[model samples]
Target: MENFDYNLVKVFCSLFDTENLTETARILNISQPAVSQSLKKLRNIYDDDLFVRTSGNMKPTIFSRKIIDNLKKSIELIELSLNQKGYNDNLFYKKNYNIVMSDLAQSFFIPPLCLLLDEANLNIDINILQVNQLEMEVKMREGKIDFAIGNFPALKDNINLISENLFQDCFVLMIRDGHPLIKSDGDFNNYNLLSLIGVDNNITGHSEVVNKILNKLGCKNKMNIPYYSAAPDIVEKTDYGVIMPSFIAKKYNFHNTFKIFPILIKENLIEVDVIYHKLFKNEKSTLTLRDMLVNNFRNR
Candidate 1:
């Protein structure tokens, strides 16, 4: 193992996780040819066919399988040692931080978080991606997402994740101010007469919960839109309404164009949590950002 290239080992581990040379190269920011060459070198060094190209994925050999856990543990240790320098105020200046958030959460959380960053004099580059529950753990493990903020139903009891409760949001009925459903102030007289305009939750993981709320409200008809940002305008134009989080509804109604009414149903509130992998539980940047988010939104 003289002059062993750790980069080749990294490519091997990444390939093991992703099962594709193209994907592994993408994750490591290298060329596909480079990945192939590294795999070739790794095979020569180990004197075994480490991985085999099948009809689908590049399946690892039994030898590779036996060492996968040790390789992961070694990589984790290296990362932990590299990040041992705890939080420093100067570390955040002009650095890029990626966060995974639901569209609804992005709408209401980013603005205030930006304000906090400004106040702290930190010129951090904040990037927000739409949350995908299925790939969240993978993304976090790969450090593709620094932090994830949203109501994650799949991660509620996931042992791999550690979460902090930021706040709880209840369901609200959002309608244009002059809609016929509103006969008077704070009164929705024709709730069932209007159809619902719902944001599709294929990626957001809120469809089941939202559907249950609509069922309780006796809303029989609904139209699904792909994005939540478009829900407000559609509700203002048509007789259709939206059942959304209280925070989003309040933020949307801030200009008085819409009215937000409380849901008259039991357990309508969902706890929005900030989640990260346990591996990063003690990392400086992760802690600093998580603490900032929790403190900013805990009371609001």
Candidate 2:
């Protein structure tokens, strides 16, 4: 293998993403020979044929796959250091930017955000997605999403991710109408509680923080309800209580149909944040939207 070619890393990443050399060349707007030459240089530097052509796609070798993440980080660091290109307001006019956010954030935060845009008379195309935690970071960096908003453990020291906490939120125990616990807040201990993985709108895994708080709140009877869909069904059929963010409980007016009780857990306040990567971090629309959220929640 020859010494590494700094510029070829971009070519290699493009090939990896496109899979086909022809398509990679087309996307890069380089001649086929130039792409082949770049691939050759990359292969020599890595001491392995990084790509094995099969079915018109380049399958990465094990060694190449192992270094892919680090290579990406380095490239991203370089991109961050060289910020000659930043997000422009004019781009919003021609292209629709994809905004990836959790269902919970969309429920509580998007209303005021959309209103803020309308009020300012900024014409921009936006699409929202509700995605789980698995491989969500990969999707964000791969350009699948221009920005992401929710609980972001996705930030890394070298990766081009930037995050900000919008505000804190808490949970309220809710149950359907005619629930035995509806009569009084103290009656909450009588019904079974179903809760999401975490109280902070996390869809990834169990939260020890939530468990500790619930333990303090006298929730001795609890079930690990993994999905959000379970909340409506369980609350409707029986006297079971579902735990969710206070914002959602209030938004749905759960107090009318169900019993809504504050957990009063002994701990720090739970918070919900809006996060985005550094590539799109400087985008005025993104920052403006973030500020609007902070303001709206403050007023709320």
Best by TM-score: 1
- Over 74-174, each residue of candidate 2 has an lDDT whose tens digit, in order, gives 77667555534443334233245677665666776678777876876667777987565555566665556666665454342325466556666776777
Question: By summed lDDT, which 10 consecutive residues of candidate 1 come out lowest?
Answer: 85-94
How much is the lDDT of residue 21 in candidate 2? 82
In candidate 1, how many Å is residue 74 off?
22
Which residue pairs clash in candidate 2? Answer: 168-271
Task: Give the CA lDDT, 0 to 100, for residue 124 in model 2.
Answer: 72
* TM-score of every prediction relative to native: 0.67, 0.56
Each model's lDDT comes to 0.77, 0.61
